[model samples]
Target: MGQFLQSFIFVLIVIILGCSKHATAAQFKGYEVKSSSTAEFNESVVRFIESQKEFLILFSKHSAFYRFPKKQSIDIQIRDFLEARSKTAVKVRVKYNPMTAEIQKIEDLKN
Candidate 1:
């Protein structure tokens, strides 16, 4: 009886592990962005926005504004462009980061 119980427990553990792996596989399916500097981030953002099919997500850090004093105007232009582009069913999501002063990541989610 003890041996049977141990086998059942092992099978249960294996099943749980398999389910967890599948869940994580579905969550981490986004493309990994590699941009360190603000310039790199801006370039990536433009490219991503131009090529995005479904959604474009950009993170604007506080430092980006400080680095480029004229960034506010550029940001406005970007938003206007995105808003225009989004008329064709594309979604634009811009998030602000107050804690940090650096761009974080650019995510292009295409469904």
Candidate 2:
């Protein structure tokens, strides 16, 4: 009886742990964006689609590609940054509005 009880508890624990992991993966299945737009896109792994002057298209493993309108200030900064890392395909942090997908800021990926 005691052995059976122990085995039951162990199985219960394993089941609980398994369920939690599945939940986490599902919850964060897509994008898994972090806070702030600058924080959201950058939190994953940012890559550009075209890096056009008029707009920016970026996505990561955990996110969907979304177009964002760019301002002159951000355009120059992003263009220059992408130029440098374009070949290298470096990971970067990005922040934007999840609701509008509008970019707010772009920064170098923190080491």
Which candidate ranks first by lDDT, i.e. highest? 2
TM-score of 2: 0.44
**Candidate 2: Cα lDDT at 24:** 44
| Predicted structure 1, TM vs. truth | 0.29
Q: Listing every candidate in turn, what is its Cα RMSD in Å to the true structure after a full C-alpha superposition?
A: 14.8, 15.0
Q: How would you encode candidate 2's per-residue C-alpha lDDT over 1-111 as one tens digit per residue?
A: 999999999999999987865444323211223444343555433556554434555555655555545556444444555554445565555566776666555455653
Residue 39 in candidate 1 has what lDDT? Answer: 36
Q: Which stretches of candidate 1 lie over 4 Å from their true place?
A: 29-111
Clashes of 2: 9
Compared with the true structure, what per-residue lDDT tens digits does model 1 show for residues 14-75? 99987865444323222223334333332222222332223333323312331111234234
